[model samples]
Target: MNILFYNDSQDQLFHISPRQRRVALAVALIMAFLTLAALFFAGTKLPVMSAFFPVLGAWGVMGDVLTSFILFNQFRSSRIFPLLLLACTFLLTGILSLFYLLSLTGMLPLSGLFASGSQTAVWLWCFWHSCFPLGILLFMGSLHFNKKIIDRRLLPRYLFSGTTAVLLIGVLLLALATAGQDKLPVLIEDGNYRRLIETAVGPAIWALCALASVCSVFPYKKRGVLRVWLSVAVFAFLLGVTLSLAAGERYTLGWYGARIDSLIASTVVLLSIISEVNKLFVRLRRQHEELEESQQALESANEQLKELSGIDSLTRIANRRKFDEVLKQELNAPQRAKEHLSLLMIDIDFFKAYNDHYGHLGGDMVLRSVAPRLEAEALAHFGFTARYGGEEFAIILPGHSELEAEQIAELMLESVRSLAIPHQYSDVSDQITISIGGCTLRPGEKSNAHDFIGRADEALYRAKHEGRARFVFANSARDSCLHPFETTSH
Candidate 1:
């Protein structure tokens, strides 16, 4: 069933543990402590770094864009409005950071992609920093109103509006930084920003950040992994902004430390998303392997069922059904165009008389003993044996001539006589004996399987009337016959 919220098992953020919350808290405190140490050395000047601003700005741009993409993807699935707002903030941060890098004076050969002038980088940085926490505040506030599932039809509109708003804000900031620079307060001057900058604008941005943190903690009582990490990230950015504002000069320890904090803040959520994706992929691969094993086992069971259907339950060999199928197959086999095949019909003498004297149980025992002995002799001739009916058995011999069939029939008779099962009611002898009748014929266009079996039965009747222990023969192979379809290959 579809729930009110889009539940994703892969999204660890949806199910935060107490340990994770503690770890997140510890991380926030550590960054806070480190930033305070950097602030203590705020005015200490260091060697100038020509590539630091551009490289760090570029790194922040890539990280922010990736984080925005991950959050946006989640928003698309869940249709959660706050997630879209949060994603837009990241995208805005990335776009503005790029502009900030390009506007810097003599930092790199790359410049003028958007607005490049005095204080243009500073104003753009302010907008980027201030707008992000404002976005966070809105996100935390909106979570309260999102008790129902979002309508999927509104998804495209929400996505387009959120992204467009970020771009429009970026364009407005560019205008203020470039065209209306004279109207704005000076945030950066003489390659340093100390009392005037820190006292007015820095504290205001800090207050905005502090309010955003309060919204996350109080209104949103149910904490998720993403929200906790976002709070930690916002806290880090707050300290980084404080560090940058306190630094009296461009090449101070505070300036570099602030950039380090920015780097950590930008990559934290993105790394978590990557780890979540890796875990899901491993689980999917394991499920696929298990499904394949189940399918293989099912196929094996089906094959065994088919084999069982053709088997005789009583004799543990081919029954009448299997014998009929094999007889039909042997008749149609293409090798019959060159060679002959034989069929044998076997019957024990005085079987019913034996049953009347010793009871049906004793007759059943005699039949069971006689079947395997015939099968053993038939196997030597590359033939198969089946229980045809009561006290009667049949054997099929492929690629056997009339003379070879006759020889095998004699061996089958001898094999049964050797059993010496006592049959006191027998008219022939005290010992159990069997009668054999067989036929050998090559396949032809005119060959009839029923006629072949009838001829063998006729021979068996003659053997029964003429003394039971002997073998009788029917029609042998007629070489001069109609050619089979296999004789002419297309």
Candidate 2:
């Protein structure tokens, strides 16, 4: 039922659409221009060759195209889109690497120079250097959007743990790559060997990033600021690695310049992915919260309904329905143990005539007053009481003998008499009074609840017939009999 998904931090940054795509394109274009201008200016000022610029521009454009495709696809579907995008991206990278290798070894003459042994080294340096700033930008952008993308998927806990581990490894790898580049002279001779070593750094870092991307497919229940922080960490590590490799010194003048441009384009693409991820995470979180709230509401409603179903609306006591249930439970145990069980049926005397005189409202007040007295007295001697019907109430006394039940009935009569409520048109005395009929099931009495109730009803009839405001005990003998008496009428 819930439609909105959000993260713990309440950040809603990732939502890729045509508008975002346009923005990304605009940013990519701007970065591309900046990279080109930097390359041209550097070439004019420094003794950098012009031939490598074209190759650098080509790689930059290709990287931008591939990244755009991947970013757009991710918004459409997480299940197949990311995988397809990654596959296409990896293929493009591989092709670019092959082309670069060909250009370096003199088999390809795109630059119009037999790539001198030095030229190949220079090309590697140029490629990474150009890519450095762009990679950092892309990584930052991805970090910004990681939350959205994470929200879109049900990532597993282990995947998040693995991502953290991979992110850590990426950080270490970046550090190592930077150290290697900084100590380029000691690590390798300043030629093609150094360039090859630098190239290895990018692929190694990319492998770590790829692992992280794959892990995103698994469910990770992480939320809030933690997701943001994790994303930032991964992006930073990747950015550091990319920049380290791209900013190295041992490249051909033209080749070095071109790599810088390509790096900028790649960076933009990665940033797009991050933005998408963030939006997805936000949506997921909102949905989760809504679902939890709905479930709680449903449970509370069910509990209330259960309570309402068991309670009597009139007197706020357990109704006849509840009485039946309680009786069944008590009877089962008492019957098994052959224990004595007593039932008292009490009714307001002359209730019909009282209603005729004072109206239903006054009668209701009288009933409410009389009902609680019966309940209190029953609970004092017996165990439970219930409003059995209009103007009628019942109490269950477990393990009570016939004599004990009669005593309890007497107590109920006394309690009702103490209320001092007036009843003018009664056939009994001048005050409000009640008639109670009680019957006790002796040990080994093999009858259902109906028989016990029938006997109590008979005794109540006898109490009313003799006079109101008295207690009547139903005889357990075969013949219908009752010892009834009036205690106090007023």
Candidate 3:
């Protein structure tokens, strides 16, 4: 749904959705079929001719040819590629028919001027035959090279080989043509410099086409090299045509001009196909990178959600559920490991009375204050702490003995007492304080975590009953005695 704007310098907008891919594929296939049909029926041999038919036929054929080329090179596995390649072969045959039509339609001005028995006619016939096979070979070669480079990462190696092959073959063919031209007396006798130029130009144009085809395999950064070769090919074709016309043997000039025009048009079309293929690759790569980034962002968000779920929202610590799980794990450790485990049960003294006098908000502030103080004391003793319930918290000291546990409890009591907030309506004492009760147990001592916790709770009950501001050891007999004031009342 998000809109993205690409400046003119950038490649076209890439459609990434499955629906768009299907649509593009369908368009490509339809174009391929139409091009094939036009190429098949577009000549004098096909007698169903309406006046508008040939023009419509040429447009359909051109559209099909270009679309087929695009689908084959840019989306090889698409149903479009194989279909288009097949259509292109038929399309080439139709172009051959058009060449024959041009000869029959008397549009070839040079054919009558050069007598039927003349060497010029023979050379023209040979050249015409060469054109069909040459066009087909170049088309197939370009497509084969394009597919190989597109589907494989070893572009440099294949490109080097293809380029070398094209260069050698093109130079050899040009040399053979030039040598043959030297012996054509009709060319020599008539001073037909145009025929000589045509003979020389054909090989150079083909060479340049081959070079352009090979250059298309390179990455964008190196495409300028390919562009340079194509420019050379275009210059040779144009210069050769100009030189042929200037040489002024009327018959030779007309014949060479027709061939030059066909070569130039085909070269332009092939170059356009290469450019579009490059554009498509660039767009697809960008979309792939964006998808990877989005996936990474999603993974990070999921990990954070998992962390948040295990944390206590109000206290910003591990919740009671997490605490129980960790406690059970510690309690189940093997006895031979000789580990000492301690638990502390802490309560904010006279919390109910405090809440009644100052309101629940004030009770919350007191609870918040007491929890952190206990946390700091527990951390100082290298223990873990969590809020056990409203106004109560628990700390686990995994390696601490009974003496160390008692000492930590005393430290927590002192830390809370030091807060020194006044509590005027409390029966226990006049200052806000905490009661801490802790128990230390060894692993494999026939004690479950619940038993250890129950002992700590019992001591906590005794601490609250006995003046409410002191630490009570779980096994101490003094913890079993009630407060002196409460005992007197009983």
Report, for every candidate in turn, its global Cα lDDT versus the true structure: 0.76, 0.55, 0.52
Clashing pairs in 3: none
Candidate 2: 10-residue stretch with minimal lDDT: 1-10
lDDT per residue for candidate 3 within 1-490, as digits (tens), equals: 0001123111112323454335433533453354334333322132233333334334433543553344334333322222233334324423433333333333334423321223433244234334434543454354434332133444334345533544454334333333343355443234333454456644554454445434332333222222232233333333333333343442333333334333443344345445545767888899999999988996896577447546666666556876786688678866416877888888887888999999988887787777788878887887878888888888989888777787777677667777877888777767787787877786546577778899999988877776677667787534322231333111
Best by TM-score: 1
Sorted by TM-score (best first), the order is 1, 2, 3
Weakest 10 consecutive residues of candidate 3 by summed lDDT: 1-10
lDDT winner: 1
lDDT of 2 by residue, 124-161 (tens): 33343323333333433443454344344444442344
Any idea how many clashes model 1 has? Answer: 0
TM-score of 1: 0.58
Question: Candidate 3 — which residues are off by over 4 angstroms?
Answer: 1-309, 477-490
Q: For model 3, what is the alpha-carbon lDDT of residue 271? A: 52
Question: Model 1, 327-377: lDDT tens per residue?
Answer: 887888878888788989988898989899899889889888999899888
Better of 1 and 3 by lDDT: 1
RMSD of each: 20.6, 20.0, 20.4
